[model samples]
Target chain A: MTMKKIVLMALAACLALGTTGVYASQADDINALRHYFKKKFPTVPFKEFANGSYALSADKRINWESMRDFPPFEDHVAKGEALWNKKFKNGNSFATCLGNDVTKVRNRFPHWNAKDKKVETLEGNIVACQKANGEKPFGLKKGNIAYLSAYIASQANGQKVNVVVPDDKDAQAAYEAGKQFFYAKRGQLNLSCADCHVYSAGMYARGNLLSPVMGHTTHFPVWRGKWAKKKGDGFGTLHRRYGGCNKQVRAKPFKAQGKEYSNMEFFHASMSNGLTIDAPDYRE
Target chain B: MKKMTLKVALLAAMMATSGFAVAMDEDSYRAEHKAATEALNKAKKVGGEWRDSRWKKSTAVKVDGKKMSYLHAAEAYAAKGDYKNAMKYAGIAKFEGEMGYQQAMDQKNAGPRH
Candidate 1:
């Protein structure tokens, strides 16, 4: 081929390859993230990462073990159970919407909704279910939603995370959007979610231990001590934690269960595919 | 005696040309403050993305032990009749504000993973 034609072809090929982003599969990312954590903290058991900061720091583990023994979220879980079982004014219950199988329902959440063209989080789905059943939707940030999420997640203890991203273009777009949000740098701090969770895991930041990104999705409906002062027991969903992390980095947080967060949850949850669910987890 | 006369003459000449340097003109102060206010407005417009709704303020951290928020500092300096300092701070504020606004715009619609 002529040199001019060869150079033009090479340039076109480079542009196409660069724009396509190597296109790692969900499984590829999951394995790579697990391997990254394994290499980082080889001594810690793979499954123990689900315990969050406790999995790394000895002091945190001791405190977390004691906290887990009493489990301050017990009261919230009980309230959630009560809410779950409570009947709507129409004589139907949330149980009716989930086909009466509440035990495994949490695993099915944050699913891709083809018709709605968005990710449907467990918290959002619960509210949608309530609204559909003639009941008032639970608030998104905390309170009823936290209580409800606590109860639902409690039901699925020991079940492995089974988040899936379907083959649809929209589903792929959403999952990609979420992954982008997780890695994108923003705020005055100019830190991405990956900066701490991926690169700086196990490092101390302002006296707090940073946990690895792997298995972050394994636990949800956390009982955080920081929130205890303002909110008794301080139960919150994964998306709420996402917002808090964004704010911690000085970035403005998107609303919980909004399109941004729902998509982020989709990508984040898929990373914890085989990790056992340990909802109602505790954290400092 | 000649040295003292030259010093006084030079002082008078400096005053005539630069208006004592420290004493900024009223119209100039107003204009400087107005420009700073305009820059502050741009920063505010772009800063909403990083602002904390609960606190209703920019998420910008303190720089050199002082918050980088230029508008308030500019206003305070203007109120104290420190127009020279006000203008200087206003310029800094304008620079930070424009950078902040640009950063917000650049990332607002970005979603690719590259």
Candidate 2:
């Protein structure tokens, strides 16, 4: 072939690959996430990632497992159950508002609500559910709502995560926004979520080990040890953790259940599509 | 007392050398704050806005018993007619805004590493 022809062919091929990369589907992104972690930690089984940072460290896993014997979060679940069963003045309860099957709650969240043309999180629904009844909504971070989340999550403990990004344009856009937030650099550190979790997974920053992004969303309403001073119990929701991360990076945290976090939850949860839920998990 | 005098002398010398010796009346401070606000808005447009200062929870620096952002510090200083300090903080905030915008532009195409 002529040199001009060869060059033109190479250019066309490059353009084709670039365009394909740009338009890769959400499923494609999830597959890429799986492949990246698999390559990074070949010995680690994918299912074990439900344990967060423990998946990468044998010592941490041993400690985490010991904690599970008398799980600090067990009492919070009982409290959550109490709250879940408590009826509103209008004779409606979380069980009634959300439905009798609590098993389905965690699996259904971080979903694209077509009616609202926005992402709806479990916390967002709880807020709406409370308003629908004759009660004030709970705060997003901690207190009753987080306790309730911990309880509801405990019910779906073994259910596989199945967050979806629908084929609709707006749904795709929301997912894209979240994907962008994950990868795009933010804050004074000029670090993206991917920078630490994806690129530097298993590495330590100061005294803490950074966990991989894979299966990050399987856990929620964690009983974090550090929260003992602030939270009545050491419990916090995923959004609360998200805020803490943002603050650590010197970025302004988006409100819990706000567009930024809800959309992020959608993308973040989908990354762990097949991983079983491990809610109210303990974390340092 | 000698150490305090030396520290004050060093600060004055640094400020004079950093082009902060110019007129720092309310009008100048306002002009600087306006520029910082505009830069911050621009950075925010691309979702690249940085914290106005290190988090108050992060640092020992405080203003009126509360740690404030560089932007807020500028405002507070201006409110007290400490125009030089106001201008200085406003400049730092403006620097952060521009840096944040540049960082966003650089990472506009950031995605999966693999």
Candidate 3:
């Protein structure tokens, strides 16, 4: 063969081989992802369960009326209302912190902190409010701040979640970290949040339909049926739910209101960005 | 003769491709159907036992036997691998057991192996 023709043929062969290699690598990556998902979520028999038909049980539905007419949280809300109206040690109520109108203040919260470059939740905002007013911060656990913030958030019941992550690198990183926390596997079950909420959602585990975590945050201060004796008490906040997720995974639950959970809550709340609040929901 | 040969060649090509496609389609359908049916049967079997026990417990006052109740008979039948009678007696036991006994009947009706 002529030298020019031989060179052209060699080049063509190399291109074909290179294309094949690229395609092979792509196929391998896809297969790896499939294998990882299958191993991680072995209990989810996707083909058999189909979509939406996986977790239909008779008793998982919550009776909303039973939740509202009860105790601890309801009482807490009353306390919060008093606090809202009561003057602080400085003769200033929380109402004085944001123009004496608690209703409009709650919806404006969970805002993007430009310096921190992350979405700070309502709880964080409350702490900031306390600090700016020279008051001690309420504990994130079963305490005044938790109750007051919940009650305050409840005021914006019909208001949509409106967290705005700034279009910056730090904001992006925080958002990604939150997403990772959701999908990353933890606990003795070696299961990720997505395994139950995304893959096996609507499917029964024991007797409950695994609810989709999407729009879940809308309902806060939930009255859980299993713990109904507490009555009107809020069972899940971002931190509380994080602890529950950790327990399910068999890992020691994180400290209430810690950074890991805060970031997770930021991401989780952001997911329900436009969904209206469904606070104080009832759940089994 | 040339036209006839061309027609035969086209027919052979079409038949080869169509046959392969049809076979693949059928195999895929069968695999999916089998998986679905297997899942359905499993769920139905579980549901059936639960329902039977629930029914028996809800209707306990109707039975008058001092002899082994259908629940006991169902347990015995299940032990012998006689699912037909086991299922029958389980249904009857469910219809004759007390309200609190439904859970026990359900466990019994599940049979030993599962």
For model 2, which pairs clash?
none
Tens-place lDDT per residue, model 2, A142-179, is 88888899899889999999887887889988888888
- B1-114, model 3: which lDDT tens digit per residue? 999999999999999998887666555444533443343334333221222222222222223342353455555555565555555665544332332133222332221010
Residue A152, candidate 2: Cα error in Å is: 0.5
Those runs of model 3 whose alpha carbons end farther than 4 Å from true positions after fitting are A1-59, A65-73, A96-99, A226-236, B1-114
What candidate 2 gets wrong by more than 4 Å, as runs, is A1-22, B1-24, B54-60
By lDDT rank, best first, the candidates go: 2, 1, 3
Candidate 1: tens digits of C-alpha lDDT, residues A1-284: 99999999988898788764455567777878888788888999988878778888888889999998999889898999999889999998888876588887899977999998999888888888899987878878777788888888888989988888887889988988888777777666777888888888899999899988778977788888887877555877788798888788765677788888898899988877888988888888
State the local distance difference test value for candidate 3: 0.55
Q: What TM-score would candidate 3 get against the native?
A: 0.53
Which of 1 and 3 is the better model by DockQ?
A: 1
Docking class of 1: incorrect
Clashing pairs in 1: none
Q: Name the lDDT value of residue B55 in candidate 2.
A: 33
